[model samples]
Target: AAVPWPEVYGAGGDSPGGAGRPTRGAGALVVVQDGRLLAHLTRGGRSVLLFSRPTMGDEDGPGATDPADVQAVVTVLSSLISVGRLSPVTVEKVNGTEVMSLGAGTRAWTEAGARFTPKGLVVR
Candidate 1:
């Protein structure tokens, strides 16, 4: 069975242009490498990631961001924070290049270190 789009959006309706509407119930894996934090969100077979620099603080650093993307990133961040997976100490560790992974659907930071990916993140 397919979920209706309206149900996904709740009572917000179809307003991608509206203020940042935090996403809910989406499974996400947050990976921190170097100064960047990448959150991979998956729900109903769809997946997208939002990347930002933890070292950048509240200022914009890098990554693509239209209004919708901003909202999505905000949603992911909100979720992470609410679950205690994101915090200043965590961000500092990430900025220091300590590898970290927050398992999807869980609030725990399962692994943290530099030896896990000494060569750094690889994309192929």
Candidate 2:
């Protein structure tokens, strides 16, 4: 099923001119990596991620506990939790994929607005 999306605005919150509307219920994501606009991924069926070429600063990691990044994630998580949704917390580790203590569906259900999930230790 094809979704619909609104016209993506530019730095001034206006259309980028001759911009085509994307499928809705799809990519409305606001992925902000290191104070830069990385991508706006979708969250529905067969969701896809859309990105931009022009970026700012080096493509370096935001380091664990990044101020801006952390604030963004926490803001999103806090809103969800306040609405009786799911709880979310970032986990720090060296080299291992952290298992979501809340289970797969718990966090994977981002489509249902269940974003921001609490991650457990990355035990290998």
Candidate 3:
């Protein structure tokens, strides 16, 4: 399957302007699909990843929303930052809590409360 770039770079494949803007060539791609959260850090076309469980049929349970699933997502997201794939800077909002844009125009405080629809990770 192909990576969903539209969802990754927001609706129009453009990163919103700010410190959150992903570095042009080397960036992290985080995807929520098939009941799993797939995060990869790419540099110079090479990619490395961290995923939440396996999205393989009935072998694995449902989507990436359970407490365990959410935790896995958080871990991988933090890894992105720790690895320098993402910047630590972000706009503070929601009671002074900081929100960072995780490439593809998606903003997340943490992976804790993420919910995905058929279209992709719900942003709002």
Question: How much does each candidate deviate from the true structure in C-alpha RMSD?
Answer: 14.5, 12.9, 12.2
The TM-score that candidate 2 achieves is 0.26
Sliding window of 10 residues with minimal summed lDDT for model 2? 93-102
lDDT of every predicted structure (CA atoms): 0.30, 0.32, 0.34
True-structure RMSD for candidate 1: 14.5
Higher-scoring candidate on lDDT, 2 or 3: 3
> Model 1 reaches what TM-score against the true structure?
0.23
lDDT of 3 by residue, 6-36 (tens): 2221213222331122233525455465655
- Model 3: runs farther than 4 Å from truth? 1-28, 31-64, 89-124
Candidate 3 displacement at residue 98 in angstroms = 14
Candidate 2 local lDDT, 1-124, one digit each (tens): 3544323323222221222333345324444656664333234212212234212434221111123433443355456547765433333211111224223312322332434334432111
Angstrom error at residue 2, model 3 = 6.3
Clashing residue pairs in all predictions, respectively, total 0, 9, 4
In candidate 1, how many Å is residue 113 off?
A: 30
Model 2 ranges with Cα > 4 A deviation: 1-62, 88-124
- In angstroms, the error of model 2 at 30 is 7.1
